[model samples]
Target: MPTAHAPGTTPITGVTIDAVLAGRLVRPLFQPIVDLSTRTVVGVEALARGPAGSALEFPDRLFAAAGAAGRLGELDMLCFERALEGAMAAPVAPPLLFANGEPAVMDQPLSPRLMELFASRPSFRAILEYTERALPSVPGSLLRLAGQIQLGGNGVALDDVGVDPMSLAFLPVLEPEVIKLDMSLLRDPHATHSRTVCAVVRGEARRTGALVIAEGIETEDDLVTAREMGAQWGQGWLFGRPGPLDGAGHRYDRAAAAAVRASRPGFHQPDGTPFEVASARAPRLPGTAEGIAAALDRVRHIAASDDAAVVVASTDDLPVSLYELAGQARSTIVLDRPVPGEFAVAVIGPGYGHAVCFRSTGGPELVMVDDLPTVAAVSRVLLNRHTRG
Candidate 1:
């Protein structure tokens, strides 16, 4: 068990990359990527750390030594392999595994060995993250390489976007699927300069349909700032620090457990009475725009008298239009793949707070108004299940 180092620890010196590699002590820790809207661990970012108590224990020091020794490629490969191994062994399946790749290696032709590694794990959706500082001086090759990566079915994320002038320059060219904002952007989200830069990144990301992730969040205010800046996903100590895969999985497990509890009968209620939870009994709708709109039309008709209804759609069957509608309506949306053939959608209102249940599949998908908080709690459980699945 390694003693977690303080965030303020100074970068250690004197570590030799060769010695670190010879020891084979480069281990991978996973930091959870949380979906702020759902409060779930949607993915994990693999961070490589050296052995505990060693000079190379700090990743910055280890990588610095590797760079000094001109063995950065070797170090990165080691980290990449170890990250895959550890992530696969985690208790909970992460939707995405984020790994760092250096430009020096990525600029060259793709490695057969790396491709084989990816091929071996068909279930893992890996995203290769490249920092702005590491971007190849020859931007063309990097962009071409990024295209190749996507062709191979993996995703690309630009780390620390807006951190450097180079990042801003390459934003349009790379057009990564995920844009990780530099933590500094949130130092003062409202500041004129910060706001301007953030808007630029946000605009480009939105234009490209890229997901924005705010990094280095350490406060509730920071989280809020990140949200205001249009970050759909977030990673930082406030969520959880980088730790062993099992540990990160445990954190996710805890969250899922809480979500399940929140969805259960007595969870938010003080009196310990039970509310009817219904499932969808109707035919499965195709997970298409028209299908979802049709289903939603039924819901809208049922809730015509109320404000809105909580909709739990199949995570595996989620339609882009449905997602957009949920976003527009500000409705409680759960996107879990393994949701049973039918689930529940509830409406709560004026007098009582507990929501009446509706079968997901059948004609009675709408329920009477109940307690608002209870309905919300149930929706969370369904959403949590989606995260876990």
Candidate 2:
């Protein structure tokens, strides 16, 4: 069990984790991401930092080793167990925990061993991460698992967004409770190709009714940059480094959560022109499930419109998920659930559905479409509008 093995020495791949895992060598370090407005410690992202002499020191190496060893399942579960255990002791525990599980694992259905882990630890809150993942095409089972997990009360988060449009397209479909920006791609001003990437992500956040977490925040500039762009919560060394959460004082060294309050996110890019930041908007979806039906009529077409996502979301001042198909009325697929609010579109299908809720201007409207095509279609409308315009 070690964190630092001699480099280029016995190369412990994924299979090697077994030798490592057997002796108890996992240390789940936690970094706190404070809310910009409340300034409260809302959530802690559980990072699996290895032991003193383990090869699991760098996450890339650790995971690469796991993959090579075909011990992905074992690695995923062990980290899950350690982090879940760690969270129970975390003082200001956020109801949510961001653990790095990929969509593929969620797709394959947990192995018997992993199922036992979940059964034994039902209280652990996990958000699957897109980092260290090679964007596997998610299938229907993962969607079912998401619905099942949300119903169980502990939820899923779409972690490390800002990687691809595919992830953003899937946001509403998965309807994660938390969506963390891949921090690396998030604040670096997007690419020179276009600025709509940020707007797309923000619109998804606005529409899906989920929390948008910006990760990889290293300095004040990164923190200010993300918050101004409308991230609900933030992670990274800028706010706090990976350390002992309990022994952690009220603040994180010099770069504290308070900075989110002190710094304002800039709408203007480094070049000074206004970056096309997604305008923040409260949802206007209908109130009751019955009302959700009516609400979709007015906006499902809007969801299908040629307007840019930022424009549509800002105009409605609402975020939504599709629930109805042909309804020409304004009703929301609103549910009796306690979900963190963000933006997405869904259409209600004939199942005991959990809604992707939005805070809308006309009231809140929820759409519930139980498939990826429907969700991706809506996201495309948003992306295409801006690109075409």
Candidate 3:
């Protein structure tokens, strides 16, 4: 008698998980997490794809095949090693690298592997994100291992929150440093259940001081809804699409990210005024006063001619001419001030003003227009709020 193939044991792809690990067929791609206020890249999540045109080319099937093949542990370790190697090899100083792992396998202490990865690059910060759909039967072991991970100077993030009841139970016990909101909840922020779950998660995050990142945002409305729901960080197509690390940090497109951040429909002014700016018109202006003046003049003349609802001005030094121009145009001015606002929304880059005073806020500030890409990317959002009373 030959032998019985395990049910669902048929390989989904021509390659086996063992072959993937041996051949190093798994490649790494990175998707960035944008700090909502700054619109700058804060972290990059490592995603695994198999060789081109392979059966495991996509992550879902790749992992599923591994599980069926009883090689989940091997595959997870390979992913961890590859992700760390790929991120470190990139030209830019690595941002926080988020590596995913299987919850069941992770029940064993990961300190050994983690310490090895960090041995050379001691300054590198790694956050192990758990993507398991269900809780381990003995969750205590996983919790203990999580504590060990922190002790080793690493952090843990619960990936895809609201996907299952088990994740809800893991929240406080695991005490994750970050909570990634599932994209499904964001697809319809108005859905009562989604709203309720968001509220619950937000409450937990506030209580725990864990940062919340809303993932899978596909539209501007999705971005707006994530912010309104109190997400401090966001990731999705609206920010930038995931791409291979390729050594040059190809995953991030600064100008493109800035444009999308600015064009989103609902930013607010200090007086609770709401306005809209066209992304096309919000060209990335130069950082200097002369550049600021010219961009302002151009926007002002055009807005006046079109009778547009908004004019955006972002400068390192608030020019009198720019203010005077706004006054002349009678358009509402959204100045990027150094002081805290009565109602200041979080924005990125140093030039955007208020955030500059706090160095700890970090990442890129809207300094020169280059930092954030364009005039529209800067101050327009600071002045636009939902229609107020």
Candidate 4:
């Protein structure tokens, strides 16, 4: 077994990236995710470290070196394998193991060895956690990977949420089993931004029954604040630091455990246009293209001031205003589809969902949906098409 390194150890230089990957110098550390109500460890997040006393010991440096060498995917897979191996070797395995995955490599096929490792431990439950950093460029990829992970009887989590306002718009699209609040929210729970994030997260959790885990809880006060913010589970120094899995066992919270095991249904479908899928669930309102366009324009104006808003529109209509919306909204996607006299727009955010789909052939009628799930479905459909095109 590789010895775990303490922080601030003497840094050794000249460790080549090849040596690190070939030698498998990465070490796995487990930090417990405690059930705040029961104070029991429900899960452990796997953290990767580099060789002891080496400059690459820090994850940022290790990953940076790998990225610079154009081997980030390989390094990411290595870290994942090490984390699983460490968990399997532990004397008292956690009920849940949360592993970090880089979005850039999430679409790649899993290694045979890793697949076998997972098969070998059929009883072990793993939840793959990713961030929103890659959503704008690769929503389709992330959605596909998430579907694959859940289909394999594992779970998915959105990590470090609240750091990006746009993440709020993706809540329904991914439908993560666990939503890990970013550490910054806990550091200043009373901040206006923090409160807004908490309210949105709490509402989503209630609607979908997703488990909320607060990160960076180092004191009793932080724990209290986390509960008030509707976090059922938490991770940080107060529970345990990232280290070997020894002395980390605790009773499981049955309800929380069940929630972790119960995977939500997939949102993205293989077939159907954005309008076809979303309109099926929502009511189509009778209106002219001009009226629908006017309503969408109003939505665009409102979304411009909202930090969490995401706006997507077809370029056939409203070409100039789309540029202005792009500058003010958290995320803006302009789809270039030539359907004369057709107009479509979707605006979604934390607590809001609105979409306008107009078809000229159908006597200038349109489908308008305000339901969150339908709106998210519309956004996903458009995003998938954009990615494929």
* Best-matching candidate per lDDT: 4
Worst 10 residues of 2 by lDDT: 267-276
Count clashing residue pairs per candidate: 17, 71, 17, 0
The sequence of per-residue lDDT tens digits that candidate 2 reaches over residues 71-98 is: 7666776776677767766665444556
- The estimated TM-scores of all candidates read 0.59, 0.57, 0.58, 0.88
lDDT of 3 at 214: 95
Q: Rank all candidate structures by their lDDT, best first, as comma-separated numbers.
A: 4, 1, 3, 2
lDDT of 3 at 173: 38
What tens-digit string does per-residue lDDT give for candidate 3 at 77-186?
A: 78888888887877763457788877656654454654687777644567878753423342334444455556545677888886653455345434577888888888
Expressed as tens digits, the lDDT of each residue in 128-234 for candidate 1 is 79887544243334545555666646777889875554465445435577889888888867777567667777777656577788998888888888999988789
Best by TM-score: 4
Better of 2 and 3 by TM-score: 3
Model 1, residue 198: displacement in angstroms? 1.6
Alpha-carbon local distance difference test for all models: 0.60, 0.50, 0.55, 0.78
